[model samples]
Target chain A: MLNKHPALLKKTLSAFAVLIFWIAVWYAAAAIVGYELILPSPLNVIISFGGLIRGGEIFAAVGASLLRVMIGYIAGVAAGVITALLTDRSAVLRQILAPMLTVIKSTPVASFIMLAWMFVGNEKLPILVSFMMVLPIIWQNTEAGLSAMDKELSEVAEIYELKFAKKLRIFIIPSLLSFVIPALITSMGLAWKAGIAAEVISHCKNSIGNGIYESKTYLETPELFAWTAIVIVLSLIIEWLLKLLGRRLMKFERI
Target chain B: MNEYNIKAQNITKRFGSEIVIDNFTCDFMPDTLYSINGASGRGKTTLLRILAGLDRNFSGILDIRGKCSVMFQEHRLFPSLSAVDNILELSFEKKDPALTDMTMSTLSSLGFSPEDMKKYPDELSGGMKQRISFARALLFKSDILILDEPFKELDENLRSVISDIILGESKHRTVIVSTHEIPEIFKNSAINIQL
Candidate 1:
């Protein structure tokens, strides 16, 4: 088994070595600074993380943040796919939605959060912000996937007279997944980050963003680092899950 | 029922300023084999595409009586599917055991091992992919079979074997094949249309 996956093993070991190197540098830097408020060591952050976990507030914060981000991510992905199909089929719709999506893509997330705060409550602002951040990315990637479809395979479908549902199952969905999966994995990190940022700005209750904000306001540098570590770990886990899902879907196509 | 399976009249195809096929006329009957012989860029693929209803940009009078199954010049197998699944996806009786058996037998005849049937298109060689494409066209239930350069990637022995299979399958349908030159086996039986 080790021989079969030597490359994957090597990659993991390399990543671990790089992480160790960075942590060592950070430890040295913290020692040189000689002040915990300025730069907390890795051990200081771990102790702070343990305190939060023991207080049971971290669970609630993590759960609330995850729920907000998941709601926005699911809705954004669904809307993106539907709109891409509509624009791909109709030139008029494409013309109408193109400029609007372009503007959304170019606009700053912070500005959108500030604007959304006016219309939405503190808890809901994060959902809207994450949705806005994810929509254009999924849309652009899905559109590119549709445009890059093999024309020859479409001609084969035409010649074979495949039914609409069959064509979608055998050709369209499989082809689109190649592009859509990467977009989904990429957008997941963006959605999580944007959702947390909106929470921090809006002062959403019972969220990791709230925890981070409180830590920063209280001058608890170690706690701030702990919250940031949680964010990074969650993003990596979500991306890894998305990749596994993509692999399973592609495996279904092969069968 | 129409006497002619396909009747194309005064078909003129042009790409921008260059003319490919100009005022070409042909009448194809059912249960006959036709070899469309031409050099590269002589519009054999274009004319076949037109007849198969894949290209509608040409000015022509075309009437096709039945469904068409095409083997494209390139092996257009789905990259995600195994060799057997690629052919099975196009079968009308996909759930039937006989269909699966027939697919396996056809693949076996075309030089595919049991292991080869489970391998995806990317894992297969160029000649193997071409044979899978040919198997798909042969197995699909259609009255008209349009094959564009079907034997272009095969060895001489495989070509002769594939030619025999094509001839054997042409007893009930109209088979139109495009090639640089007519194979020796098809020279006596196939109507050669030179462009």
Candidate 2:
């Protein structure tokens, strides 16, 4: 309806206005600093970003980084779900895994990257780090979801004599999705940041992290800003895509 | 062989220091309607839960012969599913045209329009949700149908209609219903168990 359309338009316009205000503030800060080396202007960063796009290296870097993080993210999600299911069924397993997961969650990402570097290659370190960063988040949320399931609904399932698979499909999965989707979206940002940090620490080749490191090493501040922009943009795009997928999955579940 | 569909012997349920049900015994026959009448907090739901095998923290010898379909006092419809899907999810025979037809007809009999069938629980009124819950219990293939406070939110006309439907569908099953007061339609036909 026209009412909803106007509300949506207003929201988009408000977001654009906020973005423009921040950019103007950045421009003023850059001008006041009077040094491109210290603070690159928004225009200079945009130009640098355009040059990187023209060079076509940004595409390869983005692709490689995306693939690495996605693989780790998927594996982490699978492991977390499996672990949660196992632990939910057995208190002994939950007690055994609880301390390990707590350790993983509390450990810094940089420490994990450095520790993993000794055993894994530079290229694979990022994957391991991303996986570690995501595993606890997904596990905690999935476990909470499992515990928070409606006891009454479970009674209904039992009374109706629903099979295990049917009960999972009709009840467990849908309930878990509500918790998992948010955890997934939140952990994705963490995974990407942690993966990049790992790559930077390890100096992995042909990656966004390596590009940023190289730019910093050469004191190409504008290019560094440009690479950072790319990360932000890509993270936003991925989060948006995940949100869309979540909506579709929820719809399918309802059906 | 046992002659009863369900037989409970000397059942006693307690929550810490408080006693909910004390030394209760009963036998439920097949193809019979029984109404459990009691005051509030008089262990009606507790007894129903025990019979449905949902509660195990009780001292009792309980034997149930066949599958049970229970409509709880609360309309516990799945929030994510549409009204029809909530009913249809119980059908072990999935995608059966006859089952779908039966589901539609059953919902229709409960004053649900075709449009209403597509609505989720959040979009339905309390009475409508109760009807959906009732319809789900009626449609599921079970030998025992247990309903707790099934007519709490319905008007008199709806109560009459639902009681008739309950009577019709429970002809071949053991029906154990819990209500504060037995409805007039069930007065002559149903066995009253007072607690």
Give a tens-digit lDDT track for model 1, residues A142-205: 9999999999898877777789888888898999988898899989989999999998998899
Q: Give lDDT tens digits, candidate 1, residues B27-129.
A: 8998889999999989999999999988889897998888889998888998877899888887563447888899999999888999999999988999999
Candidate 2 lDDT: 0.90
True contacts kept of each: 0.61, 0.50
Distance (Å) between predicted and true CA of B56, model 1? 1.0
Model 1 is docked with a DockQ of: 0.45
What's the residue-level lDDT of B160 in candidate 2?
90
Candidate 2 residue lDDT tens string, A37-116: 99999999999999999999999999999999999999999999999999999999999999999899888777788889
Candidate 2, residue B90: lDDT: 68
Flag clash pairs in model 2: none
DockQ numbers for every candidate?
Answer: 0.45, 0.44
Top model number, DockQ: 1
Poorest stretch of ten by lDDT in candidate 1 chain A: A246-255
Residue B94 local lDDT, model 2: 73
